[model samples]
Structures are given as structure tokens and as C-alpha cells.
Target: MGDRWHIEVDRSICIGSGMCVGHAPDGFDLDSARQSHARATTADANEKLLAAAENCPVEAITLRLADSGETVFPPED
Candidate 1:
């Protein structure tokens, strides 16, 4: 689908493993403090983002398609 996708990370569940940032630096970034919380900066669906979500040990990252109801684990990749 061509629709934009959004990603959300639960800070409470995050462990600051940096897997999200490591896998998809363009989609996610850690604060200057490099804490457990990470921010989603991109809204495009891509394999990199999916890898990031999958690499998270805590499974705190979530990827969703904004224009469609479709959702996937590791973001369809």
C-alpha cells in the first residue's frame, strides 16, 4: 500500500537496547540521554523499520498503517 505508516514505542516497556535505532536510524532515534525511550521520526513503511521493531527485545515498538486497518508484526517484513 502507498499509505503512510506510523510507529509508536512504549517507553515503559523499552529497555534502551538501541535495537530500534540501530536497525532503523531514519525511522527511530534515541534522545541525547540515550534512555530507554525512543522517538519515531518517520511515517513511511519500510523494511528497515520492520527490522527495528523486530529487533526490539521488549517488543515495545508498534507499526501501523494510517490509511488502512492492516497491521503486522515486524511490519509485514
Candidate 2:
């Protein structure tokens, strides 16, 4: 981890929900496969990004902290 929050989408779990796209268009997009993917590894961790994570109905979006490599969103089980 590089001291940046990296957002990850579990595409297998993704239900092709475009909520992530609407929340963080700059960061996420649905591929031809209809799965959410980050344009780049979660660079900014801004409000939109956080909201995107929160918006996922399936909770597929995961934000991993850089320093501790801890998963932030979805509340780590």
C-alpha cells in the first residue's frame, strides 16, 4: 500500500449497478462486461468516492487504506 486509499470493486459481486458511475464518474465506469472498475486505483478518496462506496447496493466497493492496508468501506466484516 502506498499511503493512498485504493478503491476496489468486486466485479463478481457487482450487480451492474451504475450508482458508482453516477457518484464518481471520474473514477469509476461500467465496462462492456457491465461491471464496475476504477479508471485508476482510488486516487483521491474524495466525497464522491466515499459516496460511491456507500451507494453500492451490494457493498461491492472496497476502499483499502494505504498505511495499514485496512479495508474501510463495507466495514470489514
Candidate 3:
């Protein structure tokens, strides 16, 4: 979980939940509409950030390897 990752939030499905913000404030932000957005498009891996993605009620958050584009969170089946 130390590799760089690219983060994305699916606003279409985002229910404006702040769980991501609560789980990883530095990794996520809520817009005026309350939809979550990544604080940065790319960042170093961190447990909190992974937790934010994992805890998202609608699975809106996604993380991928910055270099390989491999899925990191909501892992591939």
C-alpha cells in the first residue's frame, strides 16, 4: 500500500456521503453539493485513503496504480 495511486470518484453514483471525508479527510473532499472528490488525482498509498474507498457506501471511490493503471480498491474479481 506504499505505491502511488490514481484516485477517482464516480460522482454519478456518489450519494453525497461524507464517509470518505471522515475516513480520509486529506484524501477526499466534499463539494458544495456534498459529492466527494479526490483531494488529488494521484497520491502515495495510505491506509486511511484505502479505507475511505473501501468504506464508501456506493463504492464511488476508486484507486488505481499510477503507473500500471491496475485496480487497487474495489479490487478486481
TM-score of every model versus the real structure: 0.76, 0.87, 0.95
Cα error, candidate 3, residue 25 (Å): 0.4
* Candidate 1 Cα RMSD (Å): 3.4
The window of 10 residues in a row where model 2 has the poorest summed lDDT is 1-10
The local distance difference test score of each candidate is 0.72, 0.85, 0.94
Candidate 3 local lDDT, 1-77, one digit each (tens): 46999999999999987999999999989999998999899999989999999999999999999999999999888
TM-score for candidate 2: 0.87
Top model by TM-score, which number? Answer: 3
lDDT of 2 by residue, 23-45 (tens): 98998999898999999874855
Comparing 1 and 2 by lDDT, which wins?
2
Alpha carbon lDDT of residue 9, candidate 1?
84
